[model samples]
Target: MPRFFSNKRLIILLVGVIILVALIGFSLRDRERVTLPEQLIKDAAGVGQEVFSKPAGFVSGMIGQADLLLDSYAENKRLKARLADYAAIRSEVAALRTENEELRKVIGKQESLRAYNPIQATVIGRNPDQWEDRLILDKGANAGIAENMAVMTADGLIGKVTLVTPLTATVELLTSAGTDYRVSALVQSGSGEIHGLIEGYDAERGELLLKRIPSEFDIQPGQQVISSGLGGIFPKGLVIGEITEVTTDEFALTKMAYVKPAAEFPMLDHVMIADRIAPEIEPVELRPESGEAAE
Candidate 1:
């Protein structure tokens, strides 16, 4: 009888739980029929929108950053290319400037040569030996410059052409000590004729000795001397030098005179080539002072 009463209590507890569940369900159905609180519905919608748009905002920010990076990269590449182009242009400008300077010098030399009716040439090279006084020019047979041509500066004669190539030539200067040139000159003081041969004394110092001047001629210091044009090689009346010293001997027929060349050979930069000859002079006959009849 006690067991039956216990089972009856269990059944009553179950029935009570079932009735409570049914009443809760009926209450939820009635609540569904009524509208939700406006504030609560708005709050939920805002939360859902924020959650949905968060990813889109993040994606948009990423796209903007990527675009900025691409733009920056393109700008950097363009600047680098421009810099390279500018560098190339600068190099070209520098080269052009150098070429222009050289051209100007060449033009100046051409004008000077043209004024003197001389063959234009460029000094291409020089002798390596300090003792040897020689220079090579860029003009040669192709330019009408030949061997044995007289080379003179604006001041005076410098030398003669020794060797020539198609486009180049070599000059043998008067300062060369190994050379022997007997040149006839006129004395400025007494209008007397004198003869002298050049000899090299010192190669390094470019010192030349003039030997063989007639003693009867009154050669004085600072007297100008010029070529007599006896050999027909060099033109007449070209200035040679001035007499610096004169030593006369009582027993000797010839006097020794030291002449300083008019041209500074060491400083020779440009020279003229005169191929034209001077006009010939008429012969003069001497008459007797006592009015003697013509033979």
Candidate 2:
């Protein structure tokens, strides 16, 4: 009997659940006015759904935004890397452009003095103990450079080669202290040429002294002076300088002029070595061996 009752209760419970489901479906049908309690339950469920959906949507949006921010940071880093490489390339291009311009100027200087063989050399060394006037060249005897060769810049003569080694050469500038070397020069007057001797430099005056002027009246302050090619050491027509001041000696015998040097000595750089031509050998006169001694 108890077992029968238990079966009957289970059947009743199943039936009750089916009836409750049916009632709920009928009440939820898209239709008319509902009871207050049913409306209250629906409202409560809607509120619960809204509260959960809002937080879920907010968390999804935050994750999406974080992904976008990471992409932007990566792009910025890539751009910065490219910019650094571009800056390095640009700096190298600018340096090469400047170097090309300097080389062009050196070529132009070389072409102007086309008559003489120009041995272009860089100034390798200078002695701080000596004045800034002295210079040492990178070319020497191995390069056919010898003593007494004239050293000139782009414009005019600057010095003469005094000492030479296998790999280097020393040049004594015209502005050196206690320098007694002289150069025979000519003053280019309008009518005729006047002779002068470049003797020494005047440090206080910052000009060179051209002493023993043949005619002081012929040489004005603006007259040009050039090498006369008298001693054959320096080339003819090489410009020395222009006269700035003229005066007579204390003994009243000769005139002196303060001439500005054409070449700037303090900042000597690329120089040209005027390679002098080989001296010509005199021809031997032919005569009989017995007749030459008797005559």
Candidate 3:
């Protein structure tokens, strides 16, 4: 026809009627495998599995809040290492209660030195140039402490053992000062026996005197003076003091009296050296005096 109406045959007859209406609309939407309604295909596959499980449930709730903040910072560092192990066991129980009260005052001074037969000693040193009446003991001569051993004091006589040393010793104090100290007293309840002497005049404020007595010895003034084993060095009754002054010298015939010792040699801490040796009793025989049995 005019060359099939020319313009290249009307563009190939409108591209073959748009490829026959796109092949009849792709054979009427051929992907129609539609046989739905199983509850609308399980509600469209649960809305596409709730959009891919809402990002895996928000990344599993942010990894469970980072494992509960790393288990609460490992239980706060295990309770600060158990509170520093309870403050180092309360300072070792206060240093074992001050070493058990110094071992109960050294077992109450060994039970008051077993009542006496004594020998135990210890007063290390003193006498840095005569410290108010000497002192220095630690027991000597294998504990038989010689050289005038008598030192006494559970509350009486204190001074003798002027120097020795197998282990150490030295004590000489009855107030020391050209010292002399003999005693053998009586008159607290009276039976008569007084004989006294003790001297010293100021070995740095430790003064003392207490001299001879015999002005018809009945010496009074709170009497009490003990220790009269007669120069066996001391041992007969122990105590030695309490008669504070009773002078008399209109032409001296003996009777001075001052005594006040009863152990206080600068508060002498610990003493006792007796070493036993007092036992000799014998005297009993009577009947004869009706004018001396008719002499």
Q: Which candidate's lDDT is highest? A: 2
Residue clash pairs of candidate 2: none
| Pairwise TM-score winner, candidates 1 and 3 | 1
The number of the candidate with the highest TM-score is 2
Each candidate: RMSD to true structure? 47.9, 43.8, 50.1
- How many clashes in candidate 1? 1
lDDT by residue (1-295, candidate 3, tens digit) is: 3454678878898899999999789755423132334335434444454466456656766886798788987878887888898788777777775675578687753322113377767554457677456776655666778766678777887777755645556677777664443433443537667676554553443434556666776777777777666554455677766776678744688777666777766545457877635432221112243234311
Task: State the lDDT at 220 in candidate 1.
Answer: 79
TM-score of candidate 1 against the unseen true structure:
0.49
Better of 1 and 2 by lDDT: 2
The lDDT-based order of candidates, best leading, equals 2, 1, 3
Q: Global lDDT of each model?
A: 0.62, 0.72, 0.61
Identify the superior model by lDDT, candidate 1 or candidate 3: 1
- Decoy 2 TM-score against native: 0.54
Give model 3's TM-score versus the native structure.
0.25
The residue pairs found clashing in candidate 3 are none
Worst 10 residues of 2 by lDDT: 278-287
